[model samples]
Target: IAGRLRGLSAREARRSAEALAHELDIGPWMDRRALPEGGGLSGGIRRLTGFAMAIAAPAPLLILDEPTNDIDASRRRLLWDALRRRGDQGAGALLVTHNVAEAERIVDELVVLDRGRVVAAGSPARLRGTQDNDLRLELQLAPGAADPSELATAPPVRQRVRTGRRTLLTVAATDAARGVAWATAQREHGLLEGFTLAPATLEDAYLALTAPGAAPGSAELDPADPHQETAHV
Candidate 1:
């Protein structure tokens, strides 16, 4: 139907749709109908179909809202590649998403919104600022952690932020090994489910910005409008 709507011949429509199905790794389910919630295709596949439909429309510019929301990592990579190809073919897209880490893989420009208001806008590199020089130690707290931050109090931990079971400890590059070893020991003591060490990304900057009364070096909010903050990263 997408091809017909686009005025493609019957054969062309089938070819186009099937090719897209293969691209989205949904070729095997081409004939199956999709249902919502507890329906035929899994929720993730249904979401993938929606993305396929949008791509089928062949819009010169697409407004995608969290297109990769339910998608797994491999298929998500396919989606990103598909969009990059579309851009190469002269199409454009305005992608809206909250998966900051994943979105960094493909977004050419980013606009971070906080409570429906713009908080920051820039290319990923521009937004990361000096964050690349810092290492992030991510810890997954065990169930019912009374104080997940107890492990973050040590020296190398220049900053620590906790949300739910996830905790991000920021430290300078020189302290990367020490930070990792400390988090490793904590994991052994059953304080953490797991932990990973990596360079901080835009998400780190974003968290610091939205954090109530964040420090001046990372971000600064206009005193006149508390809601507005400039992300220096």
Candidate 2:
């Protein structure tokens, strides 16, 4: 299969072998037909080679499993761009990735697995649109920062204080716009330095769906336990 697809012929194969070596910027490695042990190319080079080999075949459907793994961020972005371009050209691509941010950026659909079970499936926007959790705001205070407690007085629903050199604030998703308004008001009042708003992520959706009762970073199970099981001995 490899021979036929890679276009291996006595003359054509030799030419392709030479071309592949030159294309990959390697010399005399085609004679070995294998990368040097402990002297192999970088992750990006290997990934690019694999991608080139796949593109050389010009297959209709490309199944990439963790194509971005071990690749540098720049190369990962390049690969993503290439995949998107391929998809735009009507090529079918199935990308399996655990990086929610990357998936959000590239994937048109999502299939979530939990405990070996297919739990949820949909597009990224659809999934995120279904979530009701409020957006989060992180406020970075400048040097000689003033307290934000004044802005916290009897304001909105569900606010939490996070102390750092700067303060991090968590609020309900519905309150995001209002929170920004409040932050702006605080800025006017000289109670805040700078602020950022973050939307709900795929990780949030996964947590909400898979472990509804589990607190973030807390092992203490929810008292309003829904998934709590009474196992038979």
Candidate 3:
């Protein structure tokens, strides 16, 4: 499309399209000329295709919402690289995603909204610094290991969940070290497959800022504002 808009020959158009396919990691799938019926193309690939088409267009601004949904890790990495490159070239992109980690990685500026209101907006580092609590420790329980109840009783655990062979523990940041130490000790004793400690994230900050009972600021959210609602951009 870009080649045609720029009045390039057919050869140039093919080359341009090929280059973009490679960049978006869709080269292998390009040979499937027929569109997938009944959504046979994975949701991620469909999104990638749309993104590729949009980026290849002559638009000065691109708005993508939840661009990474259902995308595999490898392809998602490619998408991020493409977005970063576009940013480097001074393109304007407004990306909306619930994947706060991905947003943190790619966005120079972050705007967080909850219930149709902008609760926080700033750099990832700045927003992350405002998050003072809510650390999560996830334990992958080995099958037939220690009882779930025993693990749940460990220190600093505000809440716990027991699934097939996994347990999720939510804890306070002030007690994160203690919680991690306890979980690690349990792992060393052969009671778990492994454990991971997660620090407060942009998601945490967002929740904190937009949580019910949080002090109301200048009203920025409009429940009636159509644009405030979530949409594919």
Candidate 4:
């Protein structure tokens, strides 16, 4: 990228490359002549190398398409810090990602797309604030215990999904106190391990917008859409 952007000489490019490699934790591979065959480089390394090139380039605007792909949590944090520093230095970035949590942390504005169409656009806070009183409750049930059938049919529950031994229950915010009380009662009966209550997040908003019976402003998305959920970018 440095070469293409400014016709940097091999020596000059090497300086920028080395700096970026060190920042992204790829300094060990900087002096290597060729990547090893077969396993060559891990997917995360390859992705981070590409990012290092772009970040080291002279381009004022960085257009990244899922820049955090295949990277570990530490590398992902490094990537965010790098991009944030670039922004602080007056560079512009356009990040394309399905990771709502990442976007919430990094971007100033968000545009949600569904089937090639823009479904929603706004700052993270604005979008999150639009949702009505909704709360998410996660409960870990005791081993070998089944979730009570009545819990799913409870009046406070708007939706309930069970994964392995854990169940995620969505309820009205107004009913959150009552919901916790009910969970506490169940815990007394040895049905629950523990539980958590929290306000709706960007993920919750995304799911609601794309749910099968989504409201007028939001469109129903196909369950098969791979981009519906993603790792933090």
Candidate 5:
């Protein structure tokens, strides 16, 4: 059944396998009929074969579910490169992954699903940029510190406090610029310690959208406004 879809005979499949081995940078294994030591070669061979078979089928669209699983980081990077190349040449791919960082790198579009429903869909930038008002700020503070209630109460901005030796502050997206400025001013005035701004990420959006029912001081999120809600827990 697979052979028919790939348009290749057994002999042709073997030849195609050789070509795929090279494409996946596993050409050294192609010369040996037997798998290599520690079973690594067999897995590599299987992955390369599947990848090659997908490419050889002349399909306009390819769907991969967790292609990077059980693969080393280097090979994972190669796989993403291959997919991106295919995408650039006008082929469409539906990639399902929990690895948001990898998805952010290669996928032009994103469909976020929650409980088998389409919760959000757009380009990566568009989806992530939806929460332009939210900012993640990391602080470096002295040990045995108290809560940041002083800073939190200064502005009318909604704040969620994560306390440790250092504090992680989540401020409203609209208040980010002003909030950060205020924090920096406090630091300069010996109120807080060192700090850095963390980049906003798809993970942030996912958490906010999927967090359980809201608690006090946190607003109930609107699914339509992907950016305004605080990530609980």
Candidate 6:
């Protein structure tokens, strides 16, 4: 109906919408109603439908607000891919989202905002901060671990971020073994449900760049870069 109203022939509009639906793997819900009340497509499915409708339009610029919220991992990947295709075709987009970890790989440039102020802006690599040599140890604290913050005191642990029962520890790449050993000991002692030690990621850098003492902002834009960028706030 949207396509037809936009001057697209029924067949053309349907093909466009269906193609997008399948691309996002929501093909099964194409015929469902997006009723406002109840018994319609689910929250995730409804979001997918809205996404299809947006891309179906011939808009040159797309402003996406938390497009991946409530979306599953696989479909979230598909949605990002669809946006990438849109960029490849010369259209541009402004992606407003807090899921920087998921959007990191796709973003050509990243702009970090703190309290409505632009705290940092640059290519993902440039903003990775001084922690390029760092690794992240994500610890899933056990119920018995009364205070997870104490783990930050481990000799090689350089930085830490804790939210609820999960704690992420930043350690030097050279000390990966020691960090893993420490987490393993905690897990062995039942202080952790389980823990994962991996190399630092864009999300880790995002946390660092947004730390209290970070410089106001400094980044040179590359005019030659793609116009589609993700803004992380």
Which candidate leads in lDDT? 1
Q: Residue by residue across 44-104, what tens digits does model 3's lDDT show?
A: 8777877886677445678998898888999999999988888888888998888887987
Better of 2 and 4 by TM-score: 4
Q: List the residue pairs that clash in candidate 1.
A: 127-233
Clashes of 1: 1
Sorted by lDDT, highest first, which candidate order results? 1, 6, 4, 3, 5, 2
- For model 1, residues 1-233, the per-residue Cα lDDT tens digits are 87778777888888888988999999888898666563888767877888887787466898899898888889989988988999888898999888888777788888777666565667775555444577778888989755444634544555566777987776678988877777777777788899888887778667865666555334342244332224542
Off by over 4 Å in 4: 9-11, 34-39, 130-135, 138-176, 185-195, 216-233
TM-score of 2: 0.56
What are the per-residue Cα lDDT tens digits for candidate 6 across 1-233?
77777778989998988788779998887777666663566777877777887788677898888988888888988998999999998888888899878667888886888788887777776665435677778989887576444745463555555667877776678888877777787778788898887876777666655666554652222223342122333
Off by over 4 Å in 1: 35-38, 137-169, 175-196, 214-233
Q: Candidates 1 and 6: which is better by TM-score?
A: 1
Q: Give one clash count per candidate, in the order shown.
A: 1, 4, 0, 0, 2, 0
- Note the Cα lDDT for every prediction shown: 0.73, 0.59, 0.68, 0.71, 0.62, 0.72
**What lDDT would candidate 1 get against the real structure?**
0.73
User: Sorted by TM-score, highest first, which candidate order results?
Assistant: 1, 6, 4, 5, 3, 2
**What are the clashing pairs of model 6?**
none
List candidate 5 segments past 4 Å from native.
Answer: 1-5, 8-16, 31-45, 130-135, 139-196, 214-233
The residue-by-residue lDDT of candidate 5 on 193-233, one tens digit each, is 77766666666455444445433222233445444543322
TM-score of each: 0.70, 0.56, 0.62, 0.68, 0.64, 0.69
Comparing 4 and 5 by lDDT, which wins?
A: 4
Error of 2 at 181 (Å): 8.6
Query: What TM-score would you give candidate 6 relative to the actual structure?
Result: 0.69
TM-score, cand. 5 vs. native: 0.64
Model 3 poorest 10 in a row by lDDT: 224-233
Better of 1 and 2 by lDDT: 1
Query: Measured by TM-score, how close is model 1 to the native structure?
Result: 0.70
lDDT of 2 at 160: 36
